[model samples]
Target: MQFESVSESRLSFVVCFIAAFVGCAPLLQAQTEPAAPHTFFRVKAAETLTAPVSGRLLLFLKPGSGDKEVSIDEFHPTATYVAAQEIHDLEPGEEVEVNADQLAFPKAFSELNGGLYEVQAVLDTDHNYNYAGRAPEDWISNVMALAGWKPGSTAEPELVLDHHPEEDAQRKAAYEKLKGTATADVARLEEFESPALTRFWGRPTKVRAWVILPPDYVKSGGKYPTVYWTHGFGGEIDSALVSGLRIYERMKAGKMPPMIWVMLDESCPQGTHEFADSVNDGPWGTALTAEFIPWLEKKYRMDARRDGRFVQGHSSGGWASLQLEVNYPKVFGGTWSTSPDPSDFHDFTGIDLYADHANVYHRPDGSAYPIMRDKGQVLATAEQFTRLEQVLGPYGGQMTSFDWVFSPKSVSGAPEAMFDRVTGDVDPKVVAYWQEHWDLAHVVSTHWADRGADLKGRIHVYVGTADTFYLDGAAHKFDAVLKGLGADAHFTYIPDRTHFDLYGVGDDRQGLFDEIGQQMWDVARPGKSWKNRQ
Candidate 1:
């Protein structure tokens, strides 16, 4: 391109400026130069004839051009960059433009480093990106590998949502095959309307579970003890069925006890209710104990006595079972909760809510608070995790789930946030409410004077010393309070264990169940072993 005649000094100044900032794109594009081309993605549904789709449109950008699919993985410390926008009734074969001008996780689209990136698009029809996470009817695009992609200088990606996992004939056939192999009792996904919850929400609400009967339940013709188990997080009725199938397999192989396993689902739209009766999430605990338990006992050959009922779970479910045992000691015989959520408010996932000017994002020294870690390595900080959750459409992330369960209802009819979403500032009023209502350690310490006899010898908690969410610190605090009360509760911290591997003992990944089951069995049959209990 030939330049028009210009002064020699002005031409020299331009050459000098270009030389000074040759590699800097922003600085090189000075006011004197023309603006750079804008970049955006064109996402569309497949050409195969189909109805219009409605959901939150998401674009995922991974940092490499490998074969690895760029999926939604907000929990990972170095997760893929994700930007989301809500789309309504998008027709098939119709293109829609998307950019990171709205909300994105970790960083925006334009700010992403220039490199090889694997891009993908998804349409979450259920508005449950935080919970369901690409479940049934969700549309997904094939992975598009881009080379030397920069924000504005290069051509952007164009993706097609061609895959629907829910409509996959192979997946549907596989699920049916599994169900066909299992007994009717083990295969059924039990669901019933929850009266207490319905009354609270002014809408029909139902509770669900997969009640996996003992292998010889039909042959024995005898009532058996029930073990109420709950999945940690991101678990629903279908996932519960998969887990129950594993338990059924173990029971059929005679590796597990003959007790009926009730796999409860704790996930709700507001996040995991954790079966806690809450103002925001509804009366899940009340509905479970008052309505579901009685109905379950009648329909199945379960021992109706409280002593024959045991509760146990992992992670959030762990905390739920612990709360049930503490809150309604007369209903449950015992609890073998493992790797429970923060049992003590004083150390809620490493944040001291009671401390002066407490902040979830940063400590007093201005260091960021780590929310997740593995093998002593900080995986994600509080700010990063929470901010990513904010970008994930707000309902089902772990932190928002906590607010629904722990915080009181605000004037706006939403759960009063315990901490600021962006600033991480903790609210003393909310923490005070959480301590009195939800904090197991605080509730037990304060109410032990009245309910000491009932809770004695009934509470049993196990957690890893190296918990992924820094839950061990809160467990230690919970243990101290129980010890001070001279409560007969047992708190075990398995050395070098993590949240995922706590149940494993050597080659037996589920050996802990046998041990926990035996202890509960002995309580039911005072002097007999598990072999003789049935």
Candidate 2:
């Protein structure tokens, strides 16, 4: 299982607590605090940085020297609009020099689709853009130091990244409390007994499922056409009703057709994966289909044959849906996917293409800010960077879902390759692994003709034009590849929507639900005309 970040209420409480402990009245009040004055330093590229691809370069200061804290859009000079970091406290006549080979940036210009880039540094205090509130323009000074700082005979001032220890603790605490409370109410899981179940992975894996009987289930001995609803990353078992509460509420209230909807928690321990068959992560694909489905069929009183079963999901789940149809068509009748990740690695090259920043750091002309520099000075100690690391590190240095699934080991003796998000480069092997397994375009084409006959009229896909991620590009590629392979698949694009907006809670969500429900009905029964079947 994928876990969404902690709930908002809990995060709020945590933020308040941190502010109090850190001597800030509260996050809101602290925001109003005046920025400190400081002399600016310069950062010059030891050399002209070039993009490995076409992605833009990011030269932003990370909030606390951690990936999560960096918040990319902030701190970077180019991404000033994303979220600015605050700078504090610097006396005149003091200078801090930054070094090269430590600044992290996309290696090429194509990583983020021309988004803003930032050059970041830690600061004594989080002053953000306001650090210069009353200071003279020292743009030249700042850029020069950023290029590379040589050791001076005089003692250097202490440069430091700001820390919000109290706030971070508070947020984490709140999230834990909320998760415990919410999951406490989860429905009890039942024991499984299915012979078709070849194997079970993940050791006594937390298997819990809710079987949605047909509207007329009770009167009909619980026999009904069944559809298994799986979720994408950051999904929990209850996320269906939690995140999709609005949509489910409308469906139950008659805004859309009612059918048996069985939602399974595809959420794994680490939170997410491409849901591919990886020795690195164990056999999730096998477990999901062979074990999970068989257990559901045996436990519930319903139609157990493939003809009566359908599968669907969104985002990564959407990709899973199609995978089921293509790889296990005999087990599933039809599939509905919305905003799926790319099915082919080549297509992914066009989606959120990232540059390899590590190479840039190696250039003789490429200068970088040492990880120790804070806004433009040397850090006092490693402890300081550690403090910043906790908040800003992506995954919050918490149990990263990726590591749990892909990497599987700390810097210790683990089986797979994983990178320390902070000091390590992106593991090329891991990236390659994901590309090989997760690319649908590749899978579909390679096996299409042989299996295309089995997928006719069974695949239905939808995507939003403004997808926050790269799903749109992936969908287009998938469609093109399928069309060329003689597979019967349908594609739909919803306008005026981003990723979150498309999948978010709304009354108009019926249109989306209707699309899935209709697709399920058409494939499960294969006879009556679906109202809007394309």
Candidate 3:
């Protein structure tokens, strides 16, 4: 007030003060920029495979460094509804829990029944569980590929996107084309009836088990010896159409002995179950022996006795088959396991080492942090990290299998186990837990032979030298242990072939096929005029 009638200098100072207060000058600004609103991820939801299944539900809000919250209201109440969008907070590297749930509707639509639905989760952040740009061949994509999931056509869609209308149309068109085509039909393999989706081990599982009618089924009502074929990791019951049994089909047409082949689905919901008894996980070992075998015998006209039955699988399934034969020698007369997970602590290639160390056995503090991504000593390059991720994706997705089979629950009801790979500098308590349940070094030597006495002359084992997965060492160690036990175990190592090559349509496919069939025949008939023994 006193300076109201001041000179030009005072007047200029008062005007500038008012201008700053009124935001007319550079000094005046909003308290804070409205932070880039947390954008939710947009996932596309398809209504193809929703019959009795409730309304088309969208899973939202994944964990670990991404968006944490999701809203379902954005999902299209009608047709093209936005399924889910994740709310994110911009921050440094952080971990979070990702989640999704099925949206339930009271009724089922009859028209839209029994078809496959392709849903997509748009990855908004550059931080993918497996970064696509840096490592294109990571596990997330590979598992999706195996499960028949394809990307949407949109420009870098959100974390999860429903398969676009065009993609679905393209899939139908491709299916029709393949169905009617008469070109070199290398892709078409055998198809069989898959049983209804039933609950096994408290999870949704489908068993596509079949019985090959004995050659003299019409002539003789008598039961025939049966070969119970269990498949390896990711190996479906239908894979036998491309395996040794496929050649057995050809051999039966000529001179192969007439035996019944029952290919059982050894896979649970999480994929391969390793076919073993578990504490927290479902009892696959009991399920295989009690549920599957009994179900097969009751359904098919075959000798239900042990002498007429056999079991076989490769890799993890190989380990399952061998362990099952040993555990239930009276239940199965013989077993042929290939590239088994036999050596426990001594074999460095077990499951514990390969898992994302962060997810392996946890500490009392709830963190299972690894000292380093590679062996505790070695460092991995970006490319190596990518490859290690690729390898781990398959095994990690199937973690339930290993966790259930090898690592039983502790007194506290937690998975308290560790593999030798991570055992060197890992938590001593976790290592003790693993040692208590499945120290294969002790199990294989102490119990395997005693349990497998009935299978002395019938056990057959094999592994490939160039097996891509370094699993041959465990298999070799297993062979030596079985021989030491005075059990009649046979082994064959295929030269110049990797694990992947031997399972699929290999260059020496026919020869490999023939050899496997001969082994089956030897177990089935005891005396057969087939080849491949030499």
lDDT of each: 0.81, 0.46, 0.46
Candidate 3, which segments miss by more than 4 Å at Cα?
A: 1-160, 164-208, 214-220, 237-248, 350-396, 410-414, 417-441, 503-510, 528-534
Ranking by TM-score: 1, 3, 2
TM-score of each: 0.88, 0.54, 0.56
State the lDDT of candidate 2 residue by residue for 285-330, as single tens digits: 5665777667777766646777678877877677667777777877
* lDDT for each residue of candidate 3 in 1-534, tens digit (9 for 90 to 100): 000000122234456678877867443443234422222223322233222111122322211222222222111212211222233441222222222211211111111222233333333322222211112211110001112212222222233222221235685676556434312211222222222223433445444554455445556565767776666655555454344345344444654455666665665434466666666556666666776667767756667888778787777767777777766888988887776654454453432432334223233343332211211222222122222222222223333345545665668864544432222223445544555555554565666546646767777777777665556666676667768877777878877556556544355444454455566666656775533321
Measured on C-alpha atoms, candidate 3 has an lDDT of: 0.46
Best by TM-score, which number? 1
For residue 491, give model 2's deviation from the true position in Å.
1.2
Model 1 clash pairs are: none
The backbone clash count of each candidate, in order, is 0, 73, 23
What tens digits encode model 1's per-residue C-alpha lDDT throughout 296-351? 99899988888999899888889999999988888899999999999998898898
What lDDT score goes with residue 291 in model 1? 97
Best by lDDT: 1
